[model samples]
Target chain A: MSVDAKERPLTPATEPFAEPLAELDRQRARALQMGGAEKLAKRKAEGTLNARERLDHLLDAGTFKESGLLARSARPEARAKTPADGKVAGFGKIDGRWVGIVSNDFTVMGASSAAINGKKMKHIKDVSTQRGMPLVFLGESTGARMPDRMGAIGRSILGQDRYEYRRMRETPWVTAQLGDCYGSSTWYACMADYVVMRKGATMAVASSRVTSLAISQPVDKEDLGGWKLHTAISGLVDVAVDTDQQALDLAKKFLSYLPSHSNQAPPTYPVPEGSDEPIKDILKLVPESRTQVYDMRRVIKTIADKDSVFELKPGFGRAVVTALARLDGRTVGFIGNNPMFKGGAVDPDGCAKVTGFLVLCDSFNIPIVMLVDVPGFLIGIEGERRGAPGKIINWMNALALCTVPKISVILRKSYGQAYLNMGGGRNSDEVALWPTADLGFMDPRTGVNVVYGIREEDDPALFKQKVEELSRDTSAWDLAVLYEAQEVLDPRDTRQYLIDMIEVHRLRMTNCVGEHLMRTWPTSFG
Target chain B: MAEVKVASEITGSVWKIVANIGDKVVEEDTLIILESMKMEIPILAPEAGTVKEIRVKEGEPISEGDVAVILEK
Candidate 1:
């Protein structure tokens, strides 16, 4: 302020722009510092990756192209304290395929949602959608920025983006719940096609503090939206892991099974060793007796490429196993009835899980391979209250509308409406059966009692005769004789059979792309 | 010591009780077998524990989520 215009020294005719550029360096250094060294060290000691480190672990090495490193809070007073506006967002190569990412930096103002970060999120989402790339969200937030969102100005900006929550299955969306997730974080995770949560993470509408105040009672944070609630009860999360690395690895693995966008075929990998080998162990895993229970996951693993089975919602719907795996190097969705739980009967959660998997596979041009061994649907008061009927029809509806190739293999018991839902009749492109396959409206012993009023206790011999008669024409051989199933195979030949059938049913006319009839189906139904 | 209540995951009649009171068990060891949909479904120990109580008898019908056994670990 001491120097007047006349007293100030004249600038050099040619300035190197060194001072201004140094200020640019200072600004970038401040953004990179990210809530300062102490907070970042505390985060490191807490055994979780920082925001930038998460991006490095998630994306291919040296491929992250950050979008808004200079972005700060919209409020002038808060600008100095905000870094990346609490959100680190950009585009990066995941396994050499481009994906847009948003990683919440908890070191910076709790990574809260505010005007600048919202714009940054919208920008990444828009570019990812418009340019055909998968989008990922690494979520950990403390709801909206306080005071900035507490007034008329906040109300005006709250829902200004109409398409904020509108999900179009244009490209795959994946999310990871890394810590306390509330508000937008929870919504994004809920709407994500695939979500993975760290075991200790919590995701909910509002944090327990607000929730407790609203309900006038103390609320346990974990009970509100912990991994157990999401993975085992609500079916909101696909998998729960012990750490952030596992969650990010799972995200990469999941993206490997999907295409960049709905209009293209999923990328294929080199077929793993032993993929074409006979699955002799499958015979050992499945019991020959119709009433014996076995783990269908073993059968699916033997049929898929070696080390290729990645299961989704494994804990929630124990009756059904939905997995993304590789068959002869190409991506395939495997829906199998797990006989180890509920005697392989479908339940409401199972129905919803299968329906969601069907939508994902069909939308992304991945063919489906269903391993059928279901007895029937589980009927009970709980199922009725959970809208089991609607969920069942929703599964059927998605299956009928799906344009991707769907092949089915009947392992043992395929009965009642579960038969059609598991890809019997005209539901699948090709159906095969093992010698153990039993096609029936119901179990023969149960059918005898329901139809002929025959009980083994009352008339043992007549009941046995009636059961035998009821089961007479329900064998795999009968189905083969009637041309209902395309072929009957020894259980060991299942791996090769599925690979051959998938080759036969490839969408040659459409350049390996499906019609994507289920593209607009809801991301989750339960 | 922690008490764990083992519940039946399915509605079925208890076919057999494999673990007796005070028996030491490991995780995933089948403690009871229930027959439903004409298939034998084993209710396995959720964790390593000593069986403290067997709450049902053979052939007794039980609903899903009903506590079938209690274990102390």
Candidate 2:
């Protein structure tokens, strides 16, 4: 007969509790096995750490307080093998801040199929959202398990987890695509605020094996979803690292720069020590010749704090360079036109990139610094087919919706609707310009051709004189005289002016965060 | 020897081909000029090489990343 422990506490003499205690010890041993020692050893041989080792490296020492550690698969045969339901979900400290982590244990059933895995994921996501902590997903799953999800209805029933698909950007979400990420993992990658992918990791909706079968064509996994494809072309993955260690480190660093949640302002480093390097160097970096293309990246790095720029999507939509940097220790998002690509004309892709960046900065309360040098939107058969106008207007809407402090500095060639899109005239809180800035409906050469109906080839001498006449009227001084731009600054004074502007405008924020005007705008997947 | 292709960075009409086929060019040499967005964009040779082929003639429309010249070293 069993003793009624509910009536009284157990004593040392209680013989009935001995067997149950032994069983508890056995269950604990089973929970810790995590697909057994052989798998762990194999993973170690692969020159990569196991799930627990990764958690050890990612979280602060002695800080990981795990939840759902004893959770096993619902299937009878799979129950003993699928320790922690092939998933590790818990709260931990990263850089001394609480963060929720969900890592798939690829050793167990390939971390692919389990009902409780989805539930555990939801638990961490909900907990992270409620507790105002960032969520990290270290996914390396092989997609839904076919054996467990064999029935037709089983596939549909899997989506029943309410929190799995529903997105609430209460806290920053970061994902690390460590290995073969498919199905739900791909969705999480897209939905994340930032994603770091391992160089060899394959991320897609389905594996090449299955995709090839369905389409009846051989598909290379790398070509289908490679780091180069995402970083340079698709603009899906934010950062790609060569090692798993690097991915974890970069994630921690990225979070350190951002606020814990959207309601708060981003963390700011101490003001840059010592005076800035002579800003006069920017003059030498930028070519005065309107026809020449110089490296805009150099100009950005020189103006912003030294080594502060962290560029996003450096390959895709390369005509525009979007980066997060510090100006006088204040976090600012920069959108500068790269004249090296498409002469800094905002293409359809570039428009989409800028729009998404504006929404992100607005959401995180990072102030914006626009270095305008766009000639105009891409005008061609391809640009039209790509829906350039739709993208342009969408970006314009985002810029208008952004409540964060926006300061526009026209470097050169601010023309067409692009002038407004780049925060010209009334669009920006404060508009400044360099002495060489040109603000107009179009470039003077194009303006001359449109107005006079005389091509440059038809009358070379007349065209040159006409362009000069138009150019004289379209200078930065003309705009300043008309009270269009507030100040026409020298190129050297731009850094200081921005620092001062940030200080002055920041007074408008009471608790450091803005009104969250574009809070609901979706982050761009590309 | 390696073959290099100099590509235009903008969608524009080919205004002029400065370096003819079989001509020698240094790094940063303008191989072809494209007129787009009301500006003349010079497609430059990435390395010192001899021009192997001219991809497009004058007045022909070309898109971004379209190869304008091939160079053999």
Candidate 3:
């Protein structure tokens, strides 16, 4: 028993309650010890914070109100050894907004899953969902507890909850993958709308050790589930950071732009004191020669509010840049193609990134701004193997379902289906292009070569003449004569055009967040 | 010393050679310009290094992932 519990005097009416209350206090103290002081010290030695320390860093000061504080492992032998049943869950303040958090205590049997911990997590998950409060999961577990969750008794876990994976998106959900995240940890990480993983952490359905044992060959942890896999290939994690503090800070930063629930408008910030960066700079950043590659981030930074751009999954989709930014203090989802990577072609990774970003924006009522300078969809044997066509269709499907205001500015080349996917024609609220925009199905040289079967070496003069003839079809004047594209503004006028477009569409706001069509969409690719 | 592999980002015919074997180049220095869509697309050196190998000759067709130059740092 704790020092305080044994000292309290027992009255005749309260005599029966005295022993039980002392027992409760003793259990709570043991639970707080986690795997004991030695293990906690070891965690600190590795520069990793323990369970409660993570919550302290994540939530505002002294706001954490823990639930199931006295929870013990259901397996009788494991009760004292598994305090909080290897999990710590509670309600707390994130930027003063109520949120529920579940942090796994890795000191206890590698924070393996047990029935008591599952119940604790389920309680917070349900309560957070019902109240429309954001829930954050700090995962560092090693799959299901083998002893308790096996055989006939294990079947009870599936029947414990009927409403599984039903996310109404009433409130935003965030997850942080800190260390060895297997099984349920991986599932919840994928279910979160925004997930951040730390470097050197592994997140997979099964651990490398188990896979090695099953296959009779050693498996590298990184090969199974590393930050690079999720960021560049699987498209599961949104951001990868270097520290636990950075991961926690990112989750808090994401929630700042959102409302406590879907019923309210996304929060707006005070416009920083400045006119948009000299619009003339945009022309300088974009290449006059259509074939040249230039950094598109320069243009994005100039147009968006100063220092407000936060890029997500940057390393994954090298060709396309999906980011969150403020335009005149209003939160907006920003997508732009970087020609520096693969000549601004939409690769499979780019397609997957854009699709998820569009869904997120549409669900939260954030307007989209696209800086389009696409060549076309990437073509190769690799593209086919990566399922590029299906991803392209998914991206188009998402674009069609988006009800938020979309404004696109075609900087230069906008060719093939890429133009349609980037909010051309009836897909967007407004579509405008620069005077130098090249709108066509394909490049002029390729068209001439395909039509006339003439190579530059075969007949240079004839090929030049045919190329010039085809180039005329791609000019902005051709589209302007048809009145298909909106006013062709000077590249410098793009920033003003976008700012005015956002204001022009604001009057159409119905005031409340929509019945978010993508509320229950898979947060990450399964 | 680490060797940097200079891979082409797009498929095109090499139009001009701006750097040769043993040439010292700085990051972003255009080593070769490819002709695509009748436009000049330069393949720049990714980091400062001495050109150790000229992997692809002028007028050679190169696609994405095809290494055109190798630099010794």
Reference-based TM-score of each model: 0.95, 0.88, 0.89
Residue B11 CA error for candidate 3 (Å)? Answer: 3.7
Task: Write model 1 residue lDDT over A1-526, tens digit each, in one string.
Answer: 0112234444454668656755666677778888889999998999999999999899888788888998999889999999899999999999999999999999888999999999999999999988999999999999899878988999877888999988888999999999999988899998788999998999999999999999999999899999889998899999899999999999999999999998789998998777765487777889999778888888888888989999999888889999999988899999999988889899999999999999988889989999999999999999999999999999999999989999999999999999999999999999999999999899999999999998899999999999999999999999999999999999888888888999999999998888888776677789
Q: Write the per-residue lDDT of candidate 3 for residues A435-485, one digit (tens) a residue.
A: 888987888777777888898899999999998888886777887787667
Per-residue alpha-carbon lDDT of candidate 2 for residues A1-526, written as tens digits (9 for 90 to 100)? 0122334544454576777765655665677678789999998897776777779889998788888877888778888788898888898999889999988888988888568888888889988988889999887888997687878757765878655666657788888888888876788888887788898888988998999999999999999888878876777887788988998887887787678888888887876654379466789988887787776778888888877788876777888999888888778999999887778888888888898788888877889999999899878888899888899999999889988889999998899999999999888899999998988788888889898887899999999999888888788889999999999898999999999998778835467677677666666633
Q: Model 2, residue A203: displacement in angstroms?
A: 1.4
Global lDDT for candidate 1?
Answer: 0.91
lDDT of candidate 1 at residue A280, scale 0 to 100: 73
Q: Given the true complex, what DockQ would model 2 score? A: 0.34
After superposition, the stretches of candidate 1 with alpha carbons farther than 4 Å from their true spots are A1-15, B20-27, B47-52, B71-73
Q: Candidate 1, residues B1-73: lDDT per residue as tens digits?
A: 9999999989999998999999999987989999998999888897799999999999899989999999999
- For candidate 3 chain A, the 10 contiguous residues with the lowest summed lDDT are A1-10
| Model 1 error, position A169 (Å) | 1.1
Candidate 3: RMSD to truth: 4.0
Per-prediction DockQ, in order? 0.79, 0.34, 0.37
Residue A196 error, candidate 2, Å? 1.8
Ranking by TM-score: 1, 3, 2
Q: Candidate 3 chain B TM?
A: 0.93
